[model samples]
Every structure is written in C-alpha cells, then in structure tokens.
Target: MSELHDEVLRLSGVGKTYNPGTPLAQNVLQDIDLRLARGELCALIGPSGSGKSTLLNLIGLLDSPSAGELYLQGRPTRALDDAARTRLRNRAIGFVFQFHHLIPAFSVLDNVLMPLMIRHGKPDAEDRARALELLAAVGLADFAAKKANQISGGQQQRVAIARALVTRPALLLADEPTGNLDTRTAESVFALFRRFNREFGCAVLVVTHDPRLAAQCARTVELVDGRIVRDAANTAAK
Candidate 1:
C-alpha cells in the first residue's frame, strides 16, 4: 500500500470457474482479495497451474469473475455491461503478454499508435507525438521507423512495452512478460516496468516466475491453487 491514497484496482472475494456445468467445470480461482494502488509495482508469482494469468485477466477486465466483485478506480465493474466494460478497459488498463505481439507489417511507431487508432478514427499529430515519446522513454526512439520484425527480441519487447504505455493507462497488467527472454534481458525488461510505475504513477502487476525478478518489486503476491497464499513486502533473500 505504498500509494494508499488512490486505489486503482480492487478485487474482493473474486473467483472464476470455467464450464460451470456438465462435469467439465473447474474452479480456476478461489476467494481472493487484492488491491493495487497508484504507482505500485507488484509481482505475482506462483507455480504453473496457480491461476496467475486468470487473476490478471480478471483484474484487466478481459474476463469476468464468477463470484465477488472487482472495483476499478473505485467503480464496481462486475455489473458493468459489455460496452461499459470495454470503455473502462480501454481507458484504464494496459496489457503485456509473454510474446510481443507486434504486427510484422507496421512500424514501431505505428504499432504504438494502434491503440489510439482503435479508440479513435485516425491518429493526429498529438497522438503520433505521444507514441514517439513513449518509444523514446522505452529506449527505442531511433527504432520508431523500423518494422517490428526487423528488431531483436529484446528490442521488440521494449517496443511492446512502449505500445502498452502509449495510452497512459492507470493500471498495467503483464503476464509473464519476460518469460521468453534471456536472464539479463529479463532483468532489464523488469526494470523498465519499475521505471514506468515510478515515473508515470501507473500501477503495475506483473506475473513472473523468477525469484530474482520478483525480489526487485516492492511487493509480491503469491497464488497457489487459485488462492492468494502470500501477499507481502519483498525482502532480501536469506
């Protein structure tokens, strides 16, 4: 609760179950309560089947919870309609996945502008400037004109980070964003998340398996069998 004054995302008793009937039902998450405040950088860590991604999806508003409620910026989101949810999601949440899903045909700058274009009809000068600025912030200013496929894997991931932050979202959710990168590159990528969280005051909840990576975060939340087993401050490993 470093920035307790303003909570960006809150989950209360949230749970999710897939195919709730016909003998194929499975509870992926259980009663869970978590909160992310502005400017907080938290790591979510657990084993492979611990439901970390499912929890992230619930917080991102990409998937609905089967029980409890999620509040985004203090507004109840569980009851919001599809249109309302989409609007809120676009305005409030940014997502980064393990794979940098940049379009091979689009330039780095254009790919960053894609989010804005989706929300509006076309990109104007201001939007383009913002996208470029984000690229620069991610240390990719010179690569703005390069096609995504032409960049290195680490550079491509940086471009992905820039794309996620182009909209200046209040909450950023990354699911194993560094899982596919080398150890050194993964550390650097994780540092970028820290920089954004501190510089932009955007709350970041990143799912990672590396203990070294998790140790860099201010806070860590561990999930086990869809339940939050530990949520606490990160201290030097003994």
Candidate 2:
C-alpha cells in the first residue's frame, strides 16, 4: 500500500526521560502506544506538566524517545541520523503553534511561501499559486500583499496555518493553535483544519487545552503525567 493511505504515526511503548540514568531523572511519558490514521482529526488533551509537549516533540521528530519506538509512515526513527531526521520532518510534517510566527517584514504571500523557500530557494510559479489558494481558503485572499503585522491577529494566524500546509505535508501538528484567538476566530481556524483534512487527507493531531475544542475532534486522547489515560473515539456520537 502507498504511504499516503497508511498510518501516519505510531508510538509503541514510547517514553521520555530527563537526566537519564541519574537520581534526578524524571520520566514524563511511559508505555505510550498510539496510532493516528490517515485523514483522522484527533485532539490531544492534558494538564500542565503532563508531557504533552514532550510527546509532541517525539512525534514531530524534534526530540528522541528515551525508550520504545516512534514510527512515521512505517519508518523507525530511533536510529536515524540528524540529517535523515531533518529530511523526514521537512517532507512529512507541518506544524502550527499557538503563536503565529509570521515574518513581520515579509508580505503575507511571502510569509505563506516561507516553507517551500526554505526547502528549495525561490518560489516557483506553482508554489505561489498554491500559497494563494491556501490564503483564500483561510479567508485571507486579499491580504496577501500586505505585511503580516498589518493584519488582525486572527488573520495572521490564518496565514500561519496556510504556511504550514504549503508543503502539503502528510501529517499536520498544531499545538494550542487557537489558544490566542477569540472564540469565534478560534472556531474559524479549527474549521480550516477540518476543511484541509477532508480535502487533503492529511492526518491532524492538535494539542489543545480547551475542552470545547477537544470535544469537537473525532477522537480525544487524554494524557496525565505523561501517560495516555484515555483514548476515546466516536466523540461526535457521544
């Protein structure tokens, strides 16, 4: 089967530790087994210090697990070298954080095209067209020429989401993406995630503190003290 149709991510007994092999070592996650399928939209919810961030880091390939294995598209990542990991991350993942890290001086269009430019210098015509399409999808079609700072906070965040999708990554990770927006704006932003997930078949795993947001996802995974306490599905039905 093609990778596009396979599980986007899998964690088996994944665990994290700080100051390993020492008395001060702290275990944040342990025996975490989870899988996210293609086109699935799930919410990751946990309290402060529950290791949500740590778990995300491991999934995103930004950090390594202290134990267990993390697989992306069926590729084991524990032994991958830095260059290999970076390449995989660039090719397979898109990230949106709570803060819209748009470049203030760059035009919104340029900001949205930033990822492709980083991977391959200069944007081709097709790349520009793709960015425009995303901007329009995010309701920022006309703001492309303006600087990122000139737009409303919600608008800027929309641009960030567009930027994240420009690469058409197989998996999209959002960490508290709506935490800074007003309720209305937050809903709009989340709606974009749902829209893109349906349109592109990219799996979405978002970490949010808002119960309202968590409940909206098809599946909700609750983490407590670095372990998955509950992994519930069919949320919309319940």
Candidate 3:
C-alpha cells in the first residue's frame, strides 16, 4: 500500500510474553497477524486477561512484542530506540484511554493543543486553528476556554477526543473510551470517533467490552487467551 492509503498497522506473527526466558514466563499473545487499513474502524473485543490491553500497548508503540514484527505505516518499529519510538508514536498514532487524562488546571483548548505544544513548545496559528476545528467537530467549541475540571464527564471525554485528533495521526487507538459515560453519552462519543475516522481518513482500532458498542464498528476482532479467535466484517454493525 502507498502512503495516503496504506496499511496503518500490520502485525506479522506477533507475540508477547511476560517474564520471558524465566521459569515464571507467561505468554500472553501468540502469532497475532493482523492488518488495519486506512480509514477502517475496527473493534477489538476480548475478556479480561485475554491480552487485549497488552496488544493495544504494543500496537500503540508503548510496548514491544516479544516475538515477530509490528509495522506502522509500512515501517518496522521493534528496533527503534526510545526517542525514535516516541517520535514515531507522536507523529503517527493517537490514543484515547478510558479516563480522559486531561489536566485539571489547563483550559480545554490548551489541553487539546498539548501534543502540539510538546512538540513545538508553543502552537502557531495553524495549530490553534486545527485544535479549535477539532473541538468544534466534537461539539465543544464553546467550552474551549473553560478548565477541564469545570466540564461534565462526557464533555471532558470529548476534549480528550479532540486532543487525540489534533495531530492528525494516521492511526487512532482507543481503549474503552466510552466506558465511563452513560449509554446515550457513550453512543455520542462513539459517533464522534466514526465521524473523525471519516473526516480525518484515519484508521481506528478501539478496544471495547460492551457488546452493544462493539456492534457499532464495521469489523470485529475477538481475542481470547491472547489469540485472535475471530476477525470478520460486521456489515450490520454500521
């Protein structure tokens, strides 16, 4: 695949094990081969201890695989140094976790621009404009000047979503992003993801335990005991 429309993430014979080479070594994932293409919205569903979180970390470049290879945007990443890995992650991947992780003291706009500030020390006009645009897209344009602690739970999560998209990453990874919201709020958050995936043309891989939420994704990848038991299209999910 080429740059604009290439595989966002590719795992070949990927495996992860904790305490490797020790008597207490435990393999968590094995031979996990998968490819997520550009603009695809996929759900990763699995039970507790199924290696779902572990796999997400590896894919997000927060962790490395014990075996095989993980490629992001056609580039192999296992051998990259800490600095290189961090750079790559910031440039290519966006993450939204269960908790918003917003800085309570910072205004919503500043929070959304945090990544850019980290990279450039301060954001330029274009950067600020993009952040505002994302906040608008998430339905939080008016809340930009307010502190994160001042917003509702759902609103805070929407700010997190805007923050994640500020970098215009090629891939977006979300782990239980809507887990803390009410059913209606959860659905709205999920809808924002879908809308951003389409508008930004970014591939999305979201981990979710809620079957109802998972059913909304275009594809489902079920993991059990660290293995991909099923990877199939869910046409009706849309």
**Pairs that collide, model 1:** none
Once fitted onto the true fold, the runs of candidate 3 whose alpha carbons sit more than 4 angstroms away are: 1-5
lDDT of 2 by residue, 58-141 (tens): 999999999999999989998999999998998899999999998999999999999999889999999999999999998889
Q: In terms of TM-score, how similar is model 1 to the real structure?
A: 0.96
The 10 consecutive residues of candidate 2 with the worst lDDT sum are 1-10
Per-residue error (Å), model 2, residue 172:
0.5
Rank ordering of all candidates by lDDT, starting from the highest: 3, 2, 1
Each prediction's whole-model lDDT (CA) = 0.90, 0.92, 0.94
Shift of residue 15 alpha carbon in model 2, Å: 0.6
What TM-score against the true fold does each predicted structure earn? 0.96, 0.96, 0.97
Worst 10 residues of 3 by lDDT: 1-10
* Shift of residue 43 alpha carbon in model 2, Å: 0.3
Per-residue accuracy of model 3 over 102-218 as CA lDDT, tens digit each: 999999999999999977888999999999999998899999999999999999999999999999999999999999999999999999999988888899999999998888898
Local error of candidate 3 at residue 144 (angstroms): 0.7
Total clashes, candidate 1? Answer: 0
RMSD of 1: 1.8
